[model samples]
Target: MSNTISVTLTVNGKRQTITAASDTPLLWVLREELKLTGTKFGCGVGQCGACTVHLNGEPTQSCLHALKDVNGKTVTTIEGLSPDSSHPLQKAWLVEQVPQCGYCQSGQIMRAAGLLKQNPRPTREQIVEYMSPNICRCGTYVRIASAIERAARETGAQS
Candidate 1:
């Protein structure tokens, strides 16, 4: 077994201290260690964005992130994205009825959040480009794209 390291992280605005192997992926740490299971595991290899999360306000594949390297960092999962479901993305997704299988929605929303952070007023093509990394087996691409567009519009109106 690899040597374990202790680290502290602020996830969804909560600080936690955990001991894990340096190479352990953040996905496991969040779901198994911290019990924040909103982030799903689609592909362990990072090709699928089902395990995406936010690290210091940037979207990242938690499955590809090293636990030890995230010490003292801020991590946000879908649960954090909208504890009250107030995030425009979450609200827009609901308003648009975006999820089909529901398995990939969390990752898709997180990726959409990242996209809006960079471009709050993204075009349809832009939304597709930004969200291309996340794969939805349900093929909810149309609604997903529309949901992101909706979120972008909502966010733009807020600012």
Candidate 2:
């Protein structure tokens, strides 16, 4: 009885079939298997948002998501956010210099992308509320929020 089973999912706009233990976290599958290393590993208990990715268009902690639950789902990592690092958020992050340690920036950008997908123009309060889960040891929250705001403005001017 092999615990390893084949699970197929769409990753970064590409369909992939993976074989791994059912209990293996999506984070490992993404990093070790699929070679998408932008999604970093932090707390691994879902409290820290360093491993955030878009699972079925929702920001999910990949470390907490098991391979068994991810079959047929769509995952988008920081690499998928832009092929040429041209996404509004990426440009805004550069403009705002949001990364100090650069560990949590990928997850932060992914979460902000989710927020912008749900709300194109989020207020400062909304940005804070939405992004509170991600922790930046470098204490770059202000710049993160500013980058999000800049991306929102570049994405669209909406209330």
Candidate 3:
């Protein structure tokens, strides 16, 4: 008898099906099965936000979500942020030069996008407080905050 079960997920606006152990984390499924490597794995325990992705427009730690839990749910990885890196956040990230080592950047951007979706005009303090959990070893918090603010401003203007 096989212990693996099939799960279908909507990721980055596409549907994918994979067979794996029920306990398999969404991080591995995204990276291994779907080949969406933009969502990095930092701390498997979810203390780090390297594996952040949007689940139904909410920032969620992929490392903490299991394959079974995400079945039938919509997930948006970094690739889904824009077709050509044209999302306001991506553009602002470039303008602000928010990446150093770049490992944690995708999660940072995803988390920021979620924040902006919820609160289009977050104050600097609110941005800092919400983003505090996403660890960036390169210490790019200032740049990250700047990019998020820039993106928020741009997004707000367009709305």
Candidate 4:
């Protein structure tokens, strides 16, 4: 018998229902079923942050989270950050030119959003430490950090 099952969840602020194996990774469901392609697929083992998404307001690796795990949960992809790329982080990213190859940026941004939510005014050290897990092969660490700082400032994040 097929193991596909019905799962309902909220993605990008919208309710959705999808059918798939219970263990199917959330990444595939987001990309293949829900059509939220902003979350990229990287190392697939969750080591890389390319598939990062906010799960119930927390940054999570979509590649590792199973479809069943996200049932009735809320997920926010890069596209949901801001409809017009107007999030402070997005604007700061543009101002600081944080992207190189641009493949890992969505994950980076999502993770940064989570960080800012926890610590709105993280210092440079904290920014680096918190963002360490998200790798950028293009070596744009400096720019990324700068953008995050700018974002924090623009968003009126308290020091």
The superposed Cα distance between candidate 3 and the true structure at residue 37, in angstroms, equals 0.7
TM, every model? 0.95, 0.96, 0.96, 0.95
Candidate 1 stretches greater than 4 Å from native? none
Error of 4 at 125 (Å): 0.6
- Candidate 1 on 68-121: residue-level lDDT in tens? 689999999999887698999898889899888799989999999999888888
Worst 10 residues of 3 by lDDT: 1-10
Any residue pairs clashing in model 4, and if so which?
Answer: none
List per-prediction Cα lDDT, in the order shown.
0.90, 0.94, 0.92, 0.92
Residue 58 accuracy (lDDT) in model 2: 97
Residues 1-159 of candidate 4 have per-residue lDDT tens digits of 337889999888899998999889999999999888989999999898999999999998899988878889999999898888899999999999889899999999999999999999999999999999898999999999999999999889533
Better of 1 and 4 by lDDT: 4
CA RMSD of each candidate after superposition:
1.2, 1.8, 1.5, 1.8
Per-candidate clash tally: 0, 0, 0, 0
Q: lDDT tens digits, residues 37-142, model 3?
A: 9999998998989999999889989999888788899999999999999999999999998899999999999999999888999999999999987999989999
Angstrom error at residue 99, model 1:
0.9
lDDT of 2 by residue, 35-152 (tens): 8999999998999899999999999899998899999999999999989999999999999988998999999999999999999989999999999999899999999999999999
Model 2: which residue pairs collide?
none
